[model samples]
Target: MSSGSALIPLDRALARLLDGLGPVAAETAALPDAAGLVAAETLHAPRALPVRPLALRRGIAVASADLVGATPHAPALLPSAPPVVLGGDVLPEGADAVLPADAAATSGPFHEIGQSAYPGEGAVLPGTDLTDGAVIVAAGAPITAEAVLALQLAGIAELTVRRPRIALMGDAAGAEAAWLKARLARAGCAVTDAAPADLVLHLARDPAAVVAGPGLALQPGGDAALLVDGTSRTLVLAPRADALVAALFALVFPVVAVLQGRRLATVARALTRNMASQVGLADLALLRHTPEGWEPLGVGRVTLMAILAADAVAILGPESEGAAAGAPIAAIPLQEPFDPR
Candidate 1:
């Protein structure tokens, strides 16, 4: 169902959705649960990693000066003062280097070294991995698995992050709504119908219908329109569930990022099929991953079959023309793979 209204550019539509919007309030989340959420504040390392100097190998700790003349033929005998150490053990006092077990022969309490030992060799010094007060995660940065690992290594148990409360109101029984709800939930947003929503998305079939309050209204059929103020902002999309879901993801992802106080990341992949431009209107075409590469499904041919066979969606901007086959284009992959076969 195409709306008679002129199509708004994709970038312009997103800008409208982001107008007057701010980041959601920060809340404390456990480190494990903080993945995918935006950091509300800068996280600093409370203490240095490793905590102290650690041996890197199983060997004898000794003064580097004693091993200056060590060679394969004339191996230097280490003083029977310091004790042997294993990997990850703390170096003994007054020992500045470690002679690896392979390079040293143990005889009673003394060890024979065949190689020169350099100070700080075969050992990790304190603060080498992470220093105290260093920024682990900057504000507005996404908490990734690597970030989580770093935080855990730095002994961080919890973190403050922006968890936006998004309200999903529409055809609750419809597959599109359910899919959108799950996607939003996976994006770290709290999806509910309770009052005081940071943003509301009303999914309707009618393009002219108005919804209460100021929010976005998505109409799946034809050309999409994003209206502001008390007026309804309806997005006309294809009737097929796959088409509708692709359209919803393309429109809502940026809005969620704006609300979370983070910039949306753009990812592009090679397109397997040709995609024609819509001139003024922005188009999101579903894609399927084949052995050849990513194949874009035609917009007019979008159906449950096409959706089921697709794994991603390629977005064509308003300013650009159609893309030829095998051209790299921006795309978003479906969270779960769809197998049409």
Candidate 2:
């Protein structure tokens, strides 16, 4: 008796949809324990590194005044002395610095009656090792073995991070959920709490199972994103799931996405910042394709650019083209490979 609601073409809707997700950052996030995690934070030095002057070799601390006229043939004599170990603190009282224990042979006393020690010829003095406020490491520095050593020497106990949150809702756990969770956590998210997550990942062996699952049945609260994997039964719940998918697509990716374009050398960067301690690349991809269509370009199967524009939708996979009116369409996102650099 009456025709169904006119289908909203994919192209126009998608452009509008992706444009709304807001601007993606120029740089992405990396795992906490990985090398990139330390680079993103404002890491400052705890104090002057080394804390004190360090002797480079095993030497004896001698006062400059005591070494005057001392030579290989006839050395000055003084009192008993101790051998300085490498990295030991150098004293300034009488010893200007440290002389290798084997460098000079001592016959008599350690110090002479009236000797003169030249400046800068002896062991290291206090405050000469390192100065305060000297930058041991700069901010946004990538964590390296050297950097770790520097931090440890500086006495830095902990670090701060911006980790992202990820949740998976699948029919059952085997490998897919594990794989998906790994990926999400890498994208600057903290894979911590699952109940009522910041991002709700819905996976089903069958499409209908998505709606029947507790994830869809319960009205999710908070600002959470849903990633749905298309299944055979997925098409069965087409009416409801499709609308939800459409709405979510719009929310995630709005129309006319624009970054500040430049004429030349306008290299764009996209980085995800997280506070969590653990992250992995399995959860985060630079590109992807969902059942809703190409991610960040939500054009569905029948997308349209303009009235005169040719149809840009292409069915590349084994699946056939076009579903019957009221036919369920699966929602799988086209994924882009993620590079963790």
- What is the per-residue lDDT of model 2 for residues 1-341, given as tens digits with 9 covering 90 to 100? 01111322233323333333432233433322533232344555655544444555456666666666877556666666545555456553545556656654444555332333454444445445445555543433334556566556566655544332334444426553454445344333445434353334444445434444221211111112233342110111122332233322332212111211101111122211211111110011111223442222222221222212321111111122222323333332223112212
- Using alpha carbons, what is the TM-score of model 1? 0.70
Name the lDDT value of residue 120 in candidate 1.
80
Candidates' C-alpha lDDT: 0.67, 0.35
The top-ranked prediction according to lDDT is 1
lDDT of 2: 0.35
**TM-score of each prediction:** 0.70, 0.42
TM-score of model 2 relative to the true fold? 0.42
Residue 60 accuracy (lDDT) in model 2? 62
lDDT per residue, candidate 1, 1-341, as tens digits? Answer: 23313544456666767677777779999978898777889999999877867788888787787888889888788656456799889887667667655777777877677778787887877788898899888887778788899999888999999888876555556766777677787676888864357666655665345433322222223433345563223343323464456456667676677667766554567777777765544556777777767787665345777767877766665455678888887666665221111
**Lowest summed-lDDT stretch of 10 residues in model 2?**
275-284
